[model samples]
Target: SCCPGWSATARSQLTATSASQVQAILLPQPP
Candidate 1:
């Protein structure tokens, strides 16, 4: 495969960012 490591690294980073964003939205919001 061509550029296998780069693609996987990018996907991992994207997933991590998405998870963090979701967590932030789900957390309680202050008044």
Candidate 2:
């Protein structure tokens, strides 16, 4: 039986992408 190991990698990539996007929009603006 093959386990779904790629899901972990995908999740990590998704998290990184989400974090970067959030920072790009929310962290670069001047207060």
Candidate 3:
């Protein structure tokens, strides 16, 4: 499940930054 503000964060970050950065945030590497 995504975080509560995931959508908002995504929208803001997506426009403010690059899609690559957003993708990295959305699909994080497993530790």
Candidate 4:
């Protein structure tokens, strides 16, 4: 249940354009 909900939320927020934006934001990190 928790995984389903979390995945749904993440998928919603990570739409195509937003996903790229998020990847860009994370790409410069030390990890």
| 1 Cα displacement, candidate 2 (Å) | 10
TM-score ranking from best to worst? 1, 2, 4, 3
**lDDT for model 4:** 0.77
* Candidate of highest lDDT: 1
Query: Across residues 1-31, which tens digit of lDDT does each residue of candidate 1 receive?
Result: 6887998999999999998899789985586
Better of 1 and 3 by TM-score: 1
Model 4: CA > 4 A from native: 1-14, 29-31
lDDT of 4 by residue, 1-31 (tens): 6586898787787786787888789885575
User: How many clashes does the backbone of model 4 have?
Assistant: 0
**How many angstroms is residue 11 displaced in model 3 relative to the true structure, after the best TM-score fit?**
0.6
TM-score of each: 0.73, 0.70, 0.38, 0.39
lDDT by candidate, in order shown: 0.89, 0.87, 0.80, 0.77
All candidates: CA RMSD (Å)? 2.7, 3.9, 9.8, 6.6
> Which candidate gets the maximum TM-score versus the true structure?
1
Better of 1 and 2 by TM-score: 1
Off by more than 4 A, model 3: 18-31
lDDT of 3 by residue, 1-31 (tens): 3687988887888787786777779987687
- 2, model 4: CA deviation in Å? 35
Tens digits of per-residue lDDT for model 2 on 1-31? 2558788888999999999999988888676
